[model samples]
Structure formats: C-alpha cells, structure tokens
Target: MPLPHRVSDLSAFDLLLSVAELGSIGAAARAHAITQPTASARLSGLERGLGIALLDRTARGSRLTRDGALVADWARTAVGAAAALDVGITSLRRTRESRVPVAASLTVAEYLLPHWLAALRPSAEGASVALTTGNSDDVAAAVLAGEARLGFVEGPDVPAGLTAATVGRDTLTVIVRPGHRWARRRSGITADELAATALVSRERGSGTRRALERALRRGTDRPLEEPLLELSSTTAIKAAVAEGVGPAVLSSLAVAAELAAGTLIRVPVVALDLTRELRVVHPAGQALTGTPRTLAAIARRSASLDDPAG
Candidate 1:
C-alpha cells in the first residue's frame, strides 16, 4: 500500500514543530543546521501542500498563527510517528539487535527508567531502548499485547501470561504536612491511628494500592480511613498531602525532596513493610532472557533505591 507521503516529506512537518517550540524560524532552522531560506521555503511548501497558512512570518521572527498552532500539533504527532517507525526499521536490520521495548508503571517509568537507560551505554548491549509509560495494569496490557517486550509493574502482582522477577525494591513512606500531628510520631505509627484518619490514596489498580492493601490486611480489622481524594500520579498525591488534604502512603522516592526541604514530614509507620519489590515481567512465549537480562542487571547495579523502610 502507498503511504500517505514519503518519509522525507515529513521534514517539513518537523520544521513546523521545531519552529513552534523554538518560537522562531531562524532559531529552529539553525537547530537543524539549515539556512533561513531553506527553512522558510520548507514551511511554505508544507503550508501549500496542506492547504493552509501555518505561520506568520515576521520581520523580527516567526510565530504560529491560530491555524499554525493546530498544524504544529499534527506535525509534531507526525514527527514522532516517523521517528518511531525509523527506530523500528533500524532495529530490524541489526543482526543481534536489542530494541529494548518496555512499558513500565508510572513511578518506575517517570522517576527511575531514564536514569537506568542513561547508565546503559551502547558499547555493551549495542541495543536501543524505547519506553512507554502507563499505570500498572496498562503496562501489563502492553506486554501481553506484544507492544512491549518487557514490563515493569509497581502496583500489583504480575498479570497472567507474563513471568516476573524481583529486580529491585521501592519504599513506601507515610508522609503528611510538616506540621501535622503525625510529624512527631516517628516511623512506628499504628495502623489503627492510620485507619482513623483520612489519607490521600491512589486509584484501585495502583501498585501502591496493592502494597497498602497487603499492609492493611495484616493489621487490625479496623476499617482504615477511606481516601480523602483519589489521585493518579505520585506528584498529585504528594501535592495534596502537602496541602493538608490528608496524610498519604507513597514511595519515598516520590517525596524525597519534600522531606528534605520540610515541605512534607515523614511520619513513622511501623510493623508494616510498605516496601514493594519491583519486577521485570515479559511474555511467556517470547524468550526475553537477552536484553532484559542485560538491562535488568544494569538497573540493579546503578539503582539508588535504598529507602529507610525498604
């Protein structure tokens, strides 16, 4: 089947995106090592092809008009799709390739994976890694659907169709506003008290929720306080907790800065290991013992995941 346009034609799409981001055609052109005339002509050609005016070329510089911003959005999407396709094709040509496709739950993906990927040099694996971020369940789905070769889940048990290994550990700390009553109560706070008070929480399928469930199950049958607000990201949960909304149980990694700066205070929660082991899960049919093995080893080696509760 014929593609909508040749891949090279998307250079104009990329030019539009770069100009939007850089906020000037000359600056964007220089970023791509192209002359001003070439950039201007490229933008004009793209606008002509798409049958719309995409930019307001100014004497000082260029800026996106109303239509330009909309075109910029589509062009950005096209550029990303083009890049993904390019990487996929390049990996195919490699004899012993390591196109380390991964889908990881939010915490691991947002806070940790980039560091791990940077630590992995092209010398050893001679492979490339591409990451997709999602919640625990979505990460599992991506792996099961063959969209990712490996999955890292932070929330719950590994979903079926994938075998998992304990690669690392994360600490879930109890935290509240710096001036909260729990601030004086160091790491051994009781679940009875935790249950009595309102706390911010993640949605049902969060890995944090799974760990919290296990912790609560072992404690007194007292109905713990329901969530004051259910949020998705650790950032949101911590922000709410800091605002005196409620105390929350969250990854120490999530609140390290706040704890250090006194934006939030770490309250002592005892007897329960709020720590969860992070695992690398992959499909049963695919022999994933290759890149994940190397990637996991690198992750473990450089990981600075030593939480006090862990």
Candidate 2:
C-alpha cells in the first residue's frame, strides 16, 4: 500500500510559509526566484500531502487557514534551525577567513547593503562577511550583543553605543496595483481618502511604519485607522498590495520592479514628502575606518538603488 501522506518537504513548506506571509502564489514564487505555476504545483502537492487545505483564497488574495498559520509558524522554526545547522557547518570548515559580521535592518539589506558588499569584495583583504538582517531595533541588539560589528538603520534615532552617519536617502511612495482605483491617475490624493480605505502596511517598530505614520499625520487626523493588513517584511507588504489586498505606502527604492513593470502604480500626495535618510552606524569612539571602511566604500560603488536600471 502507498503512504497515506508523505512527510513535508522543504520546498513545499517554504512555499506554504512564503504564501502565508506573502498572500499570493505568484508573489510567493517570485520571493524564492521561482515561477507562479511551479509554486502553485508545489503548494497543491503539499495540500495533498497533508490531506487538508492550507490557504483560504479569495478575489483579494490568499490567507492562511488557522491550521495553515500555525503550521507555517512551526515550519519557519524548523527552517531557521536548518539554517543554523548550515551556519555551524561553515564555522567548522577551519578556514582562515576574517569573521567580520554585519547586521543591517531590512530596508538597508533589501535595497542598499548588498550592492555595497558586492562592490566591496575587491578590498576585503580575503576577509569573509556574514550578513544578518533584522528590524532596526533588532539590528541594534545584534550589534550590542557583539554578534555584528556594524549596523545600518534608516531612521533618525541612534542606538546606544553607536555613532551614525547619513549615507543616502529613500523616498516613500504610496503604492497600489495597476488595477487599484488610485493608480488610475498621477494627481495628488487627499489624506481623508486614504483614511477611509483599507491600508496594508508594516508592523510596529518598523522604520517604514514610523516614517509613514509621521507623514500621514502631517495631513490627516490624529492616530489614523488601523491597517487592514500588517506585516513585518517589505517584500511581504509588497506582495499583499500586488494581490489587491489594499493600497500601501512603501519606499520608492524598494518597489523599482513593480513600478517599471506597471504591476504597481505610484500615487502622488501633495506637500506630503515621505523621504528618510539611510544611515550607517557602528560602535561609538571607534573609527570604522578599516576593513569596514573598505566595505562601505564598496557599498557606495555598487549601490544599485542609485541606479535601478543596472
């Protein structure tokens, strides 16, 4: 007799988890660098393996069934453990590489630092860089705990034991899918309109969320309505918006592809500039003028956000 159900595989699990965070099959596949049909197939197979439905699909997008949400959280824990194992293996390689670890908040990690690190490779003096990504608060904690030597944050506040320097700026854009009503034109919209609708956004303590709240309050009433969907990752927020979950405010630097492909439309807000400076911060009284210096140099050289076409 054949098996009643196969044990969960990594791809299926990851896809399900991604879909749960991401809210759409196409968006989930894109997150993992796969195609939509392939993601759909993997998810379907996983549903069969479990003999239960995982997603609650609708015209708006996908949501996890209560069971799926619980399973996704469990799967994420398992995947994180697997990653820790891989990291442990790398540590046992007995290599002579330098152990300089860099922690960056999600915005910097997704938009800026990768380019900087790529260009910085030539000057690394054979040192290897280990990157850890988290929220601004979490990145600061990582650095304070000695897990990373440097951090990048986008907001104005400075962490204790850290000195910050302005590196660049990222402007936030109110965005929605091409099919969204606001995307029909380029004229500025009123804050009252936004306050009346469903808003999908990042969760608390996110630099983007803080910045957005400040910007919104500049024109709207005090303490706007709660978000329709609140997520932790920029990519996840984008996915939700793409599936017509609701309109969102996001960094222009983060949505280059969607803007270029016409998948997302940028709406205008008059006198409502939503720009924030990106900063590099590290331990105070310490000159980051060494290998980190070279890394920063490389980051500036390869900063892809400056030139999105490349």
Candidate 3:
C-alpha cells in the first residue's frame, strides 16, 4: 500500500506531534530548534498536502482541531518509531556501551534525575543514560509501551498497567510573588479558599495539577475553579507567579531556589496534605534487571539519604 504523501516527510509529522505536546506552533518550533515561521510553513504544507485543516489558531495558542487530534495520534506512532531508530543508530555508532533510556516526569527530569544519574555513574563504572522528559502520564505510557526501560512519576496514584514502588516523596508548595497577599497572611489558606481562587497552574494531566486538584476536592464534591493561566512548562508557571500573575502550586523541589532567594514566597495551605510519592515504575510483571535495576537502586539510595529515618 502507498503511504500518504503528506507524511512522507517525517520531520513534518514530528512538528505536528510537537504542536500537540506543546500546545503552540511557536513553542513546538522552539523545541524543534526551528523558527516559528518555519514551523508555521511546515504545518501549513502538511495541512495542504493532507487536504485537511489540522490546527485551530487562536490568540492564546494553537490547538489540534478534531481531525488534527486524530492526525497527531497517528503521528505519535511514527515519531516513536523514528525515535527508536535514532536511538538504535546512535547506539550502533558508539564505541562504548549503550546507555539506558529512562522516561521521567518533568519534575524528576529537571531537578532529581541529574543527581541520581551522577550518583549512578561512578558506581556503575561510568554508566551512560538517555533521559526523556514528559508529564507523569506520558512517562508512565512510555514505560508501558516499552519506549523506556524505566520511568519515574510524581502523581498521587500510580498509573494502571505498570508495577511501581515508592522511591521518594515530595510535597507541593503553594507559591506567590513576594508582594502577594498570601505571602503576608499569618494563617495558612484553607482548601475552600484555594478552590475559590483562579490561580496559575500546570496543564491538565500533569501530576502537579492533579495533586493540587485532589487536595482541593477532598471532603467536598465541588469542582475546581479554572486556572488564571494554564501553562505546560513549570518554568513558565514560575515566571508567571514571580510576576504576581497569581498563586501557583508547584513541586517543592522546583521552588526551593526561588524560595531561598525570596523571589517567590511559600503560602501554606491549611488542612491540605499536598505530599505525593515519587515512584519508579516499569511494565507489570516484568522483573527488574540490568541497568534498570541498577538505576532503581541508586534512586532508592538517594531517597534514603534525603530522609533522616533511613
């Protein structure tokens, strides 16, 4: 069977996947190390060649239209295959041993994995690693799909179909600009108060956002209030909160530096247990071995070192 001419260029399919992931052509372009105009042109060309509109552009950002969503889903398979090929080719070209590929949540990838990797390297005689970053849900999916040998996630609940063990714990800290009213309050804000406010938030499906919503919805059936701004990146959220756009809940690991520098102040939430487990997960019923087992041991050791009880 002849393949569609529109997808003959794998890079164009990659850009569409990036657009779906990043929620904007500009952001996707930046991620791909291309100009916005280039990304726009590629997307336009893809749509024209496919004879279907794939994206709906708005002032806020671009989103997949109905047909676009289906295309993006199909594109994901192609991109995944390409990624596997890239990894394989790189491994073949390398003289040294192949690196273990791990998928991790943004919080873990940004703040924790580097330290763990460093700790693992010397002990494993200079082991190498390839890390992929995504939301917890995405990370879980990667592990389950065999795209990664291991995965780390920070959500309140473990994703189904993956076997998981709690490797560590982290708390969600509510942060606001120094000048925000919450920073000056003597009392911590209540769950009810938090639910009533429209604040900066991670995008839906993010573990950080899910943990926050779970805390807010406890003891009541009320729905969460819409966010003042929904950003896919934690860096964006921090920048928005630092500018006093609104209060936001983020991983304490993510905000420690900002808190110490006084650029962002922590606002305690009364009656909220925002603590969540950091988990290491792999495919269900699969026994850990090789690099995956080694990495997991290092992670657990690091977790123990951070905890006084260990």
Candidate 4:
C-alpha cells in the first residue's frame, strides 16, 4: 500500500519530535547534525503535508504550537518504533554475516579446507563455519538445493544451476603397491593400457573417479573396463592399493604421505592429462556476500599457494 503523504517522511517527523523535546529549532538542528535553516525548511514541509500549523516562531526562538505538541507526542511512538526496527535488522544482518555453511568434495574437505579455514579465522572475526563433506555431485546438489551457502567441487563440470570459479588445480595419480608389476616399470603405461586394467577405484560420483574417466575418454576409444573393486573413500582406496589389491587413480594430495613413506609407488600415465580444477561454486544468479565471499577469497589465496602456477 502507498504511504500517506502526511507521514511519508519519517526523518521530518523525527526532526519535529526533536524540536519539541529541545524547545528550539537551532538546538534540534544541532542534535540532528543539520543546519538550522535546513531543519526549519524540513519542519515547514512536514507542517504543510500534515495541513497543521506545527510551530510558533518568535524573535527569541521556535516552539511547538498546541497542535504541534499533539503531533509530536504521536510522532514519538513512530520514531521509537523505527529505532527499534533498525536495531532488529542490524542484529539479523550480523547473525547472517557471522555464520557460513559450506559444502565440499571429500578430497578438498580432507586435505585443503582445514588450512583454508584456519586462515579464514583471523579475518572472519567470530564467524563460524559449518562444513559438509561429500562427493562433487553431492556438493553441487547441496548448493542447488540451498542446503549450503557455498560449495567447493573437484570435478571438471559445474552443475547447471551453479556458478563456479577455478580456485586451484589438482592432478590425479596412478598409484600401486611396490610389489605390483606396474610399480617396476621405469616408463609409464599408455592410456589404453591403463583403461583396460581393472583397478580399485572410488564410487561412481567421486570427483577423482570422474576426473580419471574424463581423461581416459579423451585418450582412448576403447570401452573403459569396470573397476576391480569400488571403494567410497580415498583412504580406503589407498589402503587397498597398499595391500596389493590393484592400481588406483587418486589425487596427488591424497597419496603424498604414503609416497613419501615408500608405501605406495606413482606410475605415470603417458599422454593423458590427469589434472582437474578445484572450484568454488554458488547459485548462479545470487552474488556471494558476507562470510561466504570472504571464505572464498581465502580459499583461492590458500589454494594458489598450494599450486604456484595457478
């Protein structure tokens, strides 16, 4: 509904109340940090809108007339209520800015997010982060469904309803137990050879699995063989590979420790690009703001340090 003209300018009403309380136009103007003439003009406009003589101007100063006093009393309620409303809105905004909900694929959650969040703490003030870990597909779904305000994904493709920015890069590694025959090869295997072999692999929706499949599809026309075994977590895949279950494709970030410890061997794949982008995603039409935006910036900076080339 349209506001009535008489009460439309709340600032004018506030000035009127101030004038009534202070008993002079100059004092009211000083209290509101406005010049006397400006305050007088605003009150004049308000009186005209309300169709009432609101002030009695004299040589010494200005004072509220009988009608003006009645209006001032009524205006006080509105002005006080508006003040209360402003406080409430500010509180709500602060609460929203201090809480951030994020979804991330397993690899990023396990390896990257802890550091990123740690860096976020200083700038975030008292803001708290609620993290959800899942496969890339699940992260995308959470963002689309409004279950998470921001999402990090390791897969190559962004979901249709989300906007994404590449925050970093990760390379998939072909790892095997030291006793496996592929571990002994001084030279890497071809894409066709890798695709034909059944290896312990992540579940279908995992970003690591998706990245490997995307790379192989580009390099080979041969139908990709099924995994010898499907495991859900990178830790499980690493454990299986360590026990000589078979070779598995994993993110280099995931197998760094085992490789350093000589428990796992990295087998290079020839002419196949195993690198995939790490991305931060949000709903397509909405702009990221508050804590989410700050966290994304932190994530990008931190990830860049992880890959100096990014």
Candidate 5:
C-alpha cells in the first residue's frame, strides 16, 4: 500500500498540529523557528494542495475552520506517530554507540523524562541515551558509582557524593478514593494526623516516602508509624488507594489524570509542605560535559515550559 503524497510531508503535519495547539499560525511559526511569512506561505500551500480552507484568519488570530479542525485532529495523530518513530530510531542508534546512561527516579522517569528525551532527540546529532529507573537512593548511587552519566532524583536532600542542579518541582499530594473519610473532611488533615495514620506508602528509600517522613517529623516528636502496606511502585500505591485500601501520598504528576477523572480526591495536608525539588545529579567534582550537559539543558528547558511562572 502507498500513502498519499500530502501525508509524506511530516514537517507540514507537525506545523499544522502546533498551530492547532498554539491557536495562531504566527505563534506556531515562532515555536517552530520559522518566520511568520514562511509559516503563512506553507499553510497557504497546504490549503491549496488539499483544496480546502483550513484556517479562518482574523485580525486577532487564526483559528481552524470545521474542516480544518478535522484535518488538525488527523494531523495530531500523524505527528504523534512521527514522534514515536523518532524515539524508536534514536533508541536503536543508542544501542550501537557509547550512549549516555541516565538513571532517574520513578516519578521523573515515568512523567518527565520522556519529554526531555524527546526535546533532546532532534538536536542530539549522533548522541543516544540509555535510561534506568529506580528510587532516589538508587539513582544517586548509580551516578556516584559512575554507572550513570546523569541522574534525576525527587528527594529534598541530595546524596553526599553527588552534585545536584534543580531541574523541576513535583508536589506530593494526599489522595483517597471517593468514599474515603478523608475525601469528605472539610478541614485539612493535620501533620500529626497524617503521621499517625497507617496508610499505603512507598518503601523507605523512596523520595516520596522521605518527603512525607520529613513533613511528619516537623513541629512534633511523634515517630512516623509503619504503613499499612509499603509498596515499591507508585502504580501499586495508586491502585490500592483507588480500591479503598487506604489513603496514599503520591506525586501530583502520577495522579493528575485520576484526579481529573474524579477517581482520586486530593486531601489537603495543613501545616505540611509536601513540595519537593526534582534534581539532576552527577558525581561531585566531575564537570558535566558532552551528552550529559546537553541532557541537563533539555531537562531544565522542559521544566521551565511546565512552570507557569517561567
């Protein structure tokens, strides 16, 4: 089977999708590093080629017409497939070279690292990546032991032997099922209440667990109690919480979709700050160079884009 000639122009599809997302052809041009005239010409060319009016141009901005909206939806699918192909090709190239080995904590690996990797891929030249997933402790150990060129961790305290640069921020949220008692509480849970409750939790070495323990220990002498169930993975904890096993603390990134869907309700923790810095780590005294440096830059850029204030 052969594809249509118009479908072969992936860059045009990507540009169209970007325009749809950004809401203006000029904005999309700037984002794609092209001049407004160039974007306008390209879009006009695409419209003429397809024999359809794609955009309703206005003085304020441009918007997709009904037909354009349908085409943009299809363009989004094509762009996503192209991105997957790009990543796959990069991974294959990595296997043949001395790829930069990266170790990252589970939250970061699952939610943020993929975007960073994608941002780095096109400009990476011949560079490739090998990623390892672990807890904060494991990531730090991998970087310090020289097993990984770079590492990402979610904990507040950086390990002794690693130099860390704050790359992003993740807020740990307290969540419970719809029917849980905490979900119906009018007042936020106090620090003491959170500490004493035997809820589902991560393992001891996890960054999420560490952040919770630190918050619980503040302004009180009460020792943290053991969790009702200690799980090593965030997925397991989320599942348990949704099943009404117990309320659990998890990264906001991990539970965003569930929260939006109303499957998980956020229970505010009064007098406790659960926010944690996400950091990129490398062995102390080792200057970041080559692929690691590029990766760090991409991570920071990705973080800035996610930050509303940035």
Candidate 6:
C-alpha cells in the first residue's frame, strides 16, 4: 500500500518525535540544529497537513496533546523502521559493489583488519572487504596476480613491482615462557647470542622471521642458526612459547596480551633493531581510490593505538 499523502514527510515525523522527547519546540530545534522559528513553522505545517492539533502550546512551554501523544507513538515506530530500511539499502549497495578484495599478512589479518573494517561501516561508505590471509610474500603475490586489490604487510622492504605507504610499525619482541632462563636476565642479550641459538620461528618468508634475520645480520657475518621449530601461524608460535617450547622473536602486535597477562616474558635484546614498517601495498603505478584509499587513511591514523614501542 502507498504511504498516506497526509503523513508522507518523514522529516516532519522525525521532528515530531524530537519535540515529544524534548518537551519544547525550541529544544527540539536545538537538538536538530535548526532555528526555533523554522521548527515552529515546520510543526505547524505538519499539523495543518494532517488536520489535527498535535501540540498543546502555552506561554511556559509546549506539550503533546492526547491525540498528539498517540500520533507520536506511531511516529516512533515509523522513524525506526525508516532508519532500518536505510541501513538495509546501504548494506545492499555494499554487496553490489562486491567485497573489496584484500590480502594481508597474518599479523594484520588477525589483529588489525577487523578494526579498519569496523571504522568503515558507520560512515555509510557502501563498501565491504573480503580478506585473504598469508605471509608478507604471499600478500604481495596476491596483489600482483590480481587476486587482491589491496595488501598489508610488515617487513624491511616492499616486494618488487609494488609501491607501499607506511601505515604503522611493528616491533619484533623476543619472548620466552616465564620459567625460561632469559626471563631472569639482568642484562640484555647480544645479537650474536640470539643468532647462535635455535628458537621457535615463523616460516622463512614471514615478515616476523625476515625482520629478525635482517636485524641479526647487521651484527654478524655468519648465517643465522636454524629454528628449533618453525610455525606458520603467529598464534601457534605464541602457544609454543607459552608451553616452554623455546624462545621466539615475534611482532609486538602478536604478543601484547601474553606480555600483559604475564603468560610470556619479553627478553631485552641489546644493540639490535627489531622494528619494521607496517605498510599497505598496491601495484606500482596504480593509486588507491575509493574504499581502499579511505581504509588506508584509517589504518595510518589508528596505527599507534595497539603497537608496543620499539
């Protein structure tokens, strides 16, 4: 059925609800950010259009009449339903845009991407994201192959044929279980001592592993020792460390909760730089536009919220 011609104005209904809530036309006008005179004129027009007295006005204030109270109750539901319909339309538009394909390294995929996506929704951006998770190299490959339109990674360098914007930084922390020997050390361990030891590690291509190797190489000419155990996922590595598997160097992003809860101990490493850039990457010549661009800006702005200092 068609909406009634007499009550077709949704804004007027919204204003009516506001007046009902605030108890005065002037207060409602302030809430809606309009002039009191404009508010009074609009409400008057509404009553005239509906052929009913919706307000009982006196010198002190305006209050809803008996008929006005009933109309206000119905208007509340109408306004709520209209708002829900608008949200549904925005969601449909997002679907029609097709989820913006994103490739992200495990750290970003697990820890940061959801927050970025959350920031997008309330703004009515009419876009959505479909995420693919992997190591930094895998993320780069996905973007280059057209499998993803945008990619996020943390590492010493952006891969060839891609350009990156630094959105944040990740500090690789050397962590061990609370009972481990390094946990009680009064002095920081040297890079040589770290490189010579076998510890649990991320698989070779992971940004976490690469950042550690790059930092260790600066202080030694010898190749780094093999991992005691190699894990593909950050969560698994954290679990292994907490179980006293061995020491592992991981992104601060990955081990924050464990450190906070005393489940893991952060062993200081002297004279080593374990910090790496967290970046958003795309094809070399292609500039980000639309949703991806906006998301990247949000990432840059929100960078400092969770990261541990280097």
**How many clashing pairs per prediction, in order?**
4, 1, 0, 0, 0, 0
lDDT of 6 at 307: 48
On TM-score, the stronger of 3 and 6 is 6
Residues 1-310, candidate 6, lDDT per residue (tens digit)? 9988887898898998998888899999999999999999999999999889999998888999999999999989999999999999998866746578889999898888888888877653556788899999999999999898889997667878898999887788899999999999959798888999899999978888888898899977767899999999888999999999999998888888889899999998888877788899999999887787788888999877344633
State model 6's lDDT.
0.87
lDDT of 5 by residue, 168-197 (tens): 777888989999988998687888888888
After superposing candidate 3 on the true structure, give the runs of residues whose Cα lies further than 4 Å from its correct spot. 1-97, 219-221, 304-310
Q: Candidate 2 at residue 40, lDDT?
A: 82
Can you write out model 1's per-residue Cα lDDT over 1-310, one digit (the tens) per residue?
A: 7657523587888888889889899999999999989999988887887788888877887889899898777668778988999998877766345576788888888778888777776644567877888778888899999888788888658777888877688888888897888887755588777767777998888888778777777776887777788888888888888788888988887788788888998877666667788887888766756666677777767766779433
CA RMSD of all predictions? 18.2, 26.5, 23.0, 2.6, 20.3, 12.5
Task: Arrange candidates by TM-score, descending.
Answer: 4, 6, 5, 3, 1, 2
lDDT of residue 262 for candidate 4:
89
lDDT-based ranking, best first? 4, 6, 5, 3, 1, 2
Residue-level error in angstroms, candidate 1, position 123? 3.3
Off by over 4 Å in 1: 1-99, 124-126, 308-310
Model 6 off-target regions past 4 Å? 1-96, 305-310
lDDT of 2 at 259: 88
* lDDT tens per residue, model 2, 154-225: 655777798777677778778888888788766768777765666898877677777777777776784587
Whole-model lDDT, model 4: 0.89
Error of 2 at 19 (Å): 75
Preferred candidate (TM-score higher): 5 or 6? 6
Q: How far is candidate 6 from the true structure (C-alpha RMSD, Å)?
A: 12.5
TM-score of each model, paired residue for residue: 0.65, 0.63, 0.66, 0.90, 0.66, 0.67
Candidate 1 clashing pairs, residues 3+ apart or interchain: 155-207, 186-268, 187-268, 187-269
The lDDT for every candidate, in the order shown, is 0.80, 0.77, 0.85, 0.89, 0.86, 0.87
The sequence of per-residue lDDT tens digits that candidate 4 reaches over residues 1-310 is 9988779789998998888788889999999999999999999898888899999999888888999999989989989999999999999988877878899999899989999998888888989998999999999999999989999999888879999998988888899999999888879899999999998999988888898899999999988999999998999999999988899998888888888888999888889888889999999999998789988998888784242111
Residue 86 local lDDT, model 5: 94
Q: Over the stretch 1-310, how does candidate 3's per-residue lDDT look in tens digits?
A: 8866767798998999889989999999999999999999999999999999999999999999999999888888988999999999877745233467799999888988888888777666645778889888889889988888899998877767899998888888888999998999769788888888898998877888988888777734666789999998999999999887999988888888888888998888787787778899998899887667888988887873132111
